[model samples]
Target: MLINLSGVDKDNYTLSILKSLEKHNSGSLKITVVMGKTAPHINSIRQFAKTAPFECQVLVNANNMAELMAQSDWAIGAAGSTSWERCCLGLPTLLLVIANNQRTIAEQLQQVGAAISLHVQEIDTPKFTECVAFFRQPENLAQMSEKVVRLCDALGAKRVAQHIEDLTKNEDFANIRRATLDDCRQVFEWRNHADIRQFMFNTDELIWENHAAWFAKQLGNPDFIMLIYQVNGVAQGYVSFTRQSENIWEWGFYLAPTCSRGQGSRMGRLALAWAFAELGAAKIIGQVLPHNIASLKLHEKLGFFRLPEKNDVAQFELSLDKCYIKKQFHSRFKIE
Candidate 1:
């Protein structure tokens, strides 16, 4: 579990939660506490850590809040900006209304079943333990995670920037180009990343020698097209297509491991546009593992229709006409 008490009075709120946490058996439960740089009660928390039942790590002004939250199953924190960040990552949380301004944010999230909300005054051993037990069930956590992710996509900043660039520069903020030899190593690392490999049809780890040889062959082949998607000249993701026929292509894509959540959607839109408009693809085909929910949702959102499964693999296809319809909806962004 993760606990972040940055804006609230740490003296009152921190101790209350700690007292409740002490009641639960540590077992495999680990506690991570994140605080602001100048926040008080640092010594108090450190003192408790020495004798706490659970394994605890206290971070002062850590820069990797999102990373930490992503690793945690659930969180207990104030209903502030980080609430949306947790929602974007689908981390179910118990939110406390630390101030009058936070009341509405907490209440609405609770109403939507995205989070459990309570005033700081309501913190107690029984309440905290109850919430923890509720989240311990896999089905309960999954349902809450589904609801929370719909609240925010974690792309508000990117969307705003795209609009600003459209109004001012009137030039494309993102572009795609054919991959080069220089990109071989970066693409290899991204493809081999644990997160990306888990969803692949072949989950076996790839050796460098085999990957290098295969990449070299793909680079030289005319029928196999590899494109790197970039924003402001920085490579964000890669998409590849192999011509199966004169007008049909099989494709796959993966974003850089560090890229934000919604970037895959942006990359997909650009890729589909390129396949249909530039490459003259009449139809684009993709295969996704049944467990890769994110990719399945992304394919559907990009206008791909499901085809009959073959060999337990989920298949999808998009026609040029469908691509054109999707383009009309997102005409604000240049597809090239």
Candidate 2:
């Protein structure tokens, strides 16, 4: 963990980290603090750190917050602009509102699962120790990390330009919206597309009459989520989620053959973000046909892990607590 109060008179926060490090198993955790250039308590803090039982360092400042923060899994500091740095670097944090001005963003970050906030008076050994143990698990840390990144990456700008002249291109969202009964025939047509049907578990062609009934049933089921994505107001693909347990959800997605290359991955991201952020899913599970190599690689790149085969179909799962999705927000490859 990296600690930086960012110029606030909050030496207690640093003390909490030191206490937690001592309570935790030695050699398992380390803390490095970036002190303010002129804080009055710098000398005392450094002296305390020197006698710490585990590894701890107190520095007056750092060359770059982003560069150093990237090397750590977690950060603890004042809730301010530095919070944005942690979010951008995919480093989760335990934030404290040192000043009245910092409370708003701190609360917002906490509400969205991006960071945990503590009252100034609450800084102590027990609270810090609790955070240490919880974040030690790979899964919990992974989930918190992604939640912070996704919250940070919510900006709509698509980094697709190859040259300065391309800046004027419109960035249309693959706007994901819920499906209505009016979308039945459109979805049915895509579902039975020769390319889509060949890979289905039940290869028998789906008849519209039966599909309409099933689609209507899904529209009324709260446990199921069906979304139709649009680009420039034209429907291009669809993704759906089905809740298995309280926190586990399964998803499937496909694009219209007429859609542009790379649309699948883009659409998939929108759905996954919604699943983890809005639906509060702890894990997402999926399956692919044995012949679907493209689908398997796409899932893997998005952080899904392969599970044992289920009746010839390949099963995959991604835990929010253990999200391994690549940091790349967009796919670079063009699908033919």
Candidate 3:
């Protein structure tokens, strides 16, 4: 049985989570609702859950919540204490973040495949119905369970716990080298800033610290990478990497303080060139929002060719050994 109370009635977003759960078939998977400790309109959530199709459990004491969740294979909870408990127990959890603090944790968990975190605004009735039908299938549940186990192993609870400990102890910012802890802070700050946050994939309007924490989790994951470019002792811009596979990497770069003077196209080229030559990457991919003509042109200048549109997003590819690239290298690396 999976349950969540955090989104009961007060939060329209949390309500969507409950609605999605309620629509699932209960014969195979018993669905329920248990309100979080922080829910303001707890009485309203309880009333809604009582009328909910399946049995809805209520948490009288938050202290005993963990013991209750342990009896189940999966738990649906707020992206807070309950979620943390689920992570510790290696429970396949789903998140509905009702509070700002949970955004980073929810994102990090989703990144590692531990839980499913969907925004309320993006939740459509048809998609929710589809997800319920999909998860209700026996094979899908089993596959997801296996994925949760792998995620727990990949991002151990102890690592996150230790980070919280070090952070509370006033950890020094030094010793953070290439793609280190400090870089996460910078990347996160960049993402949360008014200008860049609007253009980001998450687009959640999260705090700068949340972005930092999310980036911190990605530093060690090969599937995610961040590189910063510094010139004359000032941080100019950053390049991000998300690996599609062993042979392919997806690239995204942005200049800080977009209003700052001069374009950072040269820095972008240098970064991409280093990624191909130093990283030994075979192919690099980029995506441009349809309206972003400047970025589309910049990618073209770097020899990126178009790929089939997926979800209306413009996809471009740069192959390492293309004829044009070979010619340029021959011109530069030719013997005197």
Highest lDDT against the true fold, candidate: 1
The CA lDDT at 295 in model 2 is 90
Model 1 C-alpha lDDT per residue in residues 165-224, reported as the tens digit of each score: 778695436767889888999898989999989988888888988999998889999799
Tens-digit lDDT track for model 3 on 99-158?
788889889888877777755454545655565565556676566666666544435668
| Residue runs of model 1 more than 4 Å from their true location after superposition | 1-172, 325-336
Instruction: Estimate, for each residue in 1-336, the C-alpha lDDT of model 2 and write its tens digit.
Output: 788887746455666556656666746667788877877778777887788776777777567777778888788888988798789888988887888999998999999998888876666657866776776777887999989988666242344344433753566545677888988999999988989887778878788899999999999998998988788778898889999999999998888878888877777776777677668888999999989887988898787889999899999999877762322332321111
Segments in model 2 whose C-alpha atoms lie over 4 Å from true places: 1-170, 324-336
Candidate 1 to truth, TM: 0.48
Instruction: Point out the higher-scoring one by lDDT: 1 or 2.
Output: 1
Model 2 clashes, total count = 1
Q: Which candidate is the best by TM-score?
A: 2
Q: What TM-score does candidate 2 get on C-alpha atoms? A: 0.50
**Cα shift from native, residue 327, model 2 (Å):** 9.9
Cα lDDT for residue 247, candidate 1: 96
Per-candidate Cα lDDT values, in order, are 0.84, 0.79, 0.64
Q: Positional deviation of 152 in candidate 3, in angstroms?
A: 68
* Alpha carbon deviation, residue 243, candidate 3 (Å): 1.3
